[model samples]
Target: MCNNISFLGPKGTFTHEAAYILEGNLIPYCTIPAVMESVSNGECQFGVVPIENSIEGPVGLTLDSLAHKFDLKIFKEMVIPINQNLIVNPKTVMNDITDVYSHSQAIAQCQEFIRDNEIQPHYAVSTASAAKSILGDKTKAAIGNSKAAEIYGLEILKPNIQDLDNNETRFVVLSKNDHEPTGRDKTSIIFSIYEDKPGMLYKILGVFEKESINLTKIESRPSKKGLGKYLFFVDFYGHRKDKTVQNILNELDGLTYFLKVLGSYPEF
Candidate 1:
């Protein structure tokens, strides 16, 4: 069995918690691309990185990296509920904090709280990184999860500080091989249309509709080629190997300028 699983971390990050649900030795990397590169080069058997958040939308770097740099397939997926907390040194109180640090997504999640308290918000590489940086500083606090506070020996000055309580993040496990058809699976794909014509996107989407395929999610990101040019990312319910799904792909092949099957994995 493969042993090492790389995740975005220095420990105490939300991705670290998501890594716990998988088997093998957990290794931490500083960035999402680093984690993917570890898996691509076989340094690790698998890697976990956040793909999207309910409140903050898609993680652009992760999506862009998968679309452009990595050939790895998504082997599995996990969705975890999020709860952000205000973590600080035990000796520090709310009045002592002038600046707060955390991942950009985490900071955005707690915008209301930060504005209300008039604390300067700074972005860190990861939530745990932020918590670790303020270990002895009374003027700085971090917005992270409870586990981060515990791991760093910090205190939670405030709990559940996110703007919304239903916050969740979706993480994907990257691996060299696609998972076997699990009957109930979701396939992710990326494609760019041929022209800027008005019906280009509509025609491509119609391929799925013609087959009655149920699409779970759809979003667009810049292709980085030029302005108004984009790549479309889609998730749908069905394994890539399914006959119906295969036929849909065959049809899409002719309609798109570029097409790539990211992977098929058991849906969360």
Candidate 2:
């Protein structure tokens, strides 16, 4: 029940669209760090940040920030379906465009279209920023959501330009307030093994198997301490407070360099 929420944006970014449910004061931040920091420092009651994508994988900054920067907890999650469109000025045509602008990730999502059109890709801070920058320019275009087109008074030259038909991003709601256990919930955690012994990862995962916990996702990110040192981020179907999950976590503490429970949130 947050009264205000912050998201990565200047508006029209997918994160902005995903945050509509809060129905609160919407604050747009420039970067993921700024969004998380806003909630950590009490500038806002909640912050919405993208954590993973169906095609491109985990958002690195969000993972690193959750693992290292803030002690915030995830309150909820939602999957945002991405429909990247080719947006242009009303006077522009496909062949008339000289350059296309968008966030790097958006450009990648629309690679097939960009390659086919032969337009140079310019990176922008956000999809909405790209749309805003292309105003009054017949030679420029942007790749972003339809909202960006509406916000910037542009037109959708092509719709659903993403490489895949069902492209989507998973976003998490971050807050200083801890969430109570919902009957259907998932727990996220990050752990690092002190030793690089063989089967260490398998052994860690074994705890989940022993306790009958169903793991939905597992990914390794750099530990940032040194090369080849990594921390494993695991998501599974159950709250941290559940008896089985607590038992597994208690056992994991002894086998890990450190075990940090990122949060327990209701599944999207």
1-268 per-residue lDDT for model 2 (tens digits)? 4477999998999998999877789999999999999998888999999999988889999999888888988888899899999999996778899999999999989888888878899999899999999999999999999989999899998899888877999999999865789899999899998765777888888898888899989999999899989989999999888898889989999889978898899988
Residues 131-179 of candidate 1: C-alpha lDDT, one tens digit per residue: 9999899999999998899998999998999999889999999999879
> Per-prediction TM-score, please?
0.97, 0.97
Q: Candidate 1: where are CA atoms >4 Å away?
A: none
Q: What is the C-alpha lDDT of each candidate?
A: 0.94, 0.90
In candidate 2, stretches whose alpha carbon ends up further than 4 angstroms from where it belongs are none
- List the pairs of residues colliding in candidate 2: none
TM-score of 2: 0.97
| TM-score between candidate 1 and the true structure | 0.97
